[model samples]
Target: MIRLALIGIGTGHPDHLTLAAIKAMNAADLILLPRKGDAKSDLLDLRRTICAEILTGPTHVAEFDMPERAATLPYLDAVDAWHDAIAAIWMREIGRHLPDGGSVALLVWGDPSLYDSSLRIAARLGSVAIHVVPGITSIQALTAAHGICLNELARPVLITTGRQLRERGWPDEADSVVVMLDGGCAFQGLAADGMSIWWGAYLAMPQQVLIRGPLATAGPEIMARRAELRQAHGWIMDTYLLRRERAAISRDAPTS
Candidate 1:
């Protein structure tokens, strides 16, 4: 049986790796990196940089072209199909590199438990022994970069995707919400009153950028900046946390 290690690398930053993640990389018989054309080649480059910096001794490395998703399908359907395709690709790669059933590792961006699909794809391999090495997540890096807590003290924090934020608006139960995979500027849909936002792009990386203010005041600025950066880099990964301040009651109130 092929031993698969799903190692989280975290937000395109080499320093975000934990000691366990590094050790997993070194122990792997094969390390597979996915290439998504030139525009996103920086992603694979980051993976390679981590290996060069951390991995010692001779270990096999494989790079494979990533499959493109069908754009005609609806978003969820498209992503589902894409994940299926990726699983197939992964099986092929593993078969070629580990015909004898040895340990293989794939470097994932951010923690696999988040919005990432590596875990789901691995399940498709059918009864393989899977190990996970957790790394720093973008949410953690985003919060730390902005020097803010993830939630109001004693309050619940909701972690969600950009699509959910756009469709459902801000959740009623969560005073604090962390948004990820937000390519559509979902924060703009929120009612800004009493709300504060802490935003970061490329968190924990050299090109890191950050913004924070009342959502009403900073929403437009963040939108504009996000667009500019997306144009410059051809891709962007960003995350943010939003919280609402408690509203004050009227001075003249009826006593019970």
Candidate 2:
């Protein structure tokens, strides 16, 4: 039986790796690293660095070029097709390296249970036993970097993507929203009144940048900074938390 372990590495930080992640890496018979081409080679380099620093076993490491999604197809169809291509590549690599079926590991960014689709891709490998090791999410990193709570006092938080936010506007009854995978700064479209935003780019990394204030004040700043960072780094992975102010709840109102 093939044992596939999807280990979350957390924001590409070596220290963010959990003990279980390390053990899984060392125990794996082979580790597959996907290179995202020259534009995002830094991502592949980070994975290599983590393996070099942590692997004490004789695990074989292999690198493959990642498949790019088709821009012409509709978003959902494009993503579905892209995942299928990735799964095929994974199977081909696994067969080539571990012909007899052995343990394999793929280092995933953040927890796979989040917006990440590593788990979904892995499910394509029929009959392969899978294990997951949770790691810090970008949301946690953003909140920690800003030193703020994820939710307002007794209020709920909603996590969505820039595409959804742009198309649907702010979700009904959701005061706190976390946005990820936003290539376009969608927050600028929203009415900035009574809203606060805490934004972070490259969270938990040496090149991390953070900005926070009323949306009216910080919205433009974040847009400019995001542009500059993307130009400098060739790519950027950022997430932000947006909160719409609500009626103040009395401190004595319900302790339970």
Candidate 3:
């Protein structure tokens, strides 16, 4: 049986690695790293740097080129096909390296359970026992960096994607929303009135950027900065938290 461990290495920061993540990396017989092309070479390099820093034993490391998802297909269909392709690659690599099946690990960015598809892809590998070593998520990193709470007292917080926020406006009954995987500044599309935003890019890394204030005032600044950062780095990962003003809700409420 193949024992597969998905170890989360939070936001490419060496210090963000939990002790469990470190132990898992050292314990693995083989570790697979996906190369996402030249534009995102820094991502793969970050994985290499982490391995260099913590790997104590002779664990074989392998790198595979990632398959690009077809942009022509519908979003859901494209993602499903991409996951299948990734799973195939995983199997091929594992077979080539560990024909007799032992423990193998993949370094996941942030926690595997949050907006990451490593777990879903691993499930396709029939009969493999999966283990997860949780690391700090980008959400945690964002909130921590800004020194704010994730949710207001007695209010529900909705964690969603940029696509969802764009297609469907702010979710009803949610006072706070955390947006992830947004390449474009989707917040720009929302009605900025009565909203506050805390935005961060490259959280926990040396190149981190943060902006927070009334959405009306900070939204444009974030868009401009995001473009600059993406241009400079060739890639970027960012997330933000938006909270609706409680006073505005109270003012809009109809008297009983």
Q: What would you estimate as the lDDT of candidate 3?
A: 0.94
Highest TM-score against the true fold, candidate: 3
Q: Model 2 over residues 164-242: C-alpha lDDT tens digits? A: 9999988766789999999999998888878899999989888999999999989999999999999999999999999
Kindly indicate the candidate among 2 and 3 with the higher lDDT. Answer: 3
Please give the CA lDDT of all the candidate structures.
0.87, 0.92, 0.94
lDDT of 1 by residue, 1-256 (tens): 8999999998887888898998899999999999999888777778889888988967899999999999999988998899999999999999998888899999989988888899988898897899999878998898888877887778899999989999987676777889988888898887787788899998877778899999998888899999998889888888889887655112222358
Clash pairs detected, candidate 3: none
Cα displacement (angstroms), candidate 3, residue 115, comes to 0.4
| Weakest 10 consecutive residues of candidate 2 by summed lDDT | 247-256
lDDT of 3 by residue, 1-256 (tens): 7999999999989999999999999999999999999999999999999999999999999999999999999999999999999999999999999999999999999999999999999999999999999999999999999999999987899999999999998787788999999987888898777999999999988899999999999999999999999999999999999998988666655699
Error of 2 at 118 (Å): 1.0
Total backbone clashes of candidate 2, pairs 3 or more residues apart or in separate chains: 0
* lDDT of candidate 1 at residue 213, scale 0 to 100: 96
Off by over 4 Å in 3: 251-256
Quote the positional error of residue 47 for candidate 1 in Å: 0.8
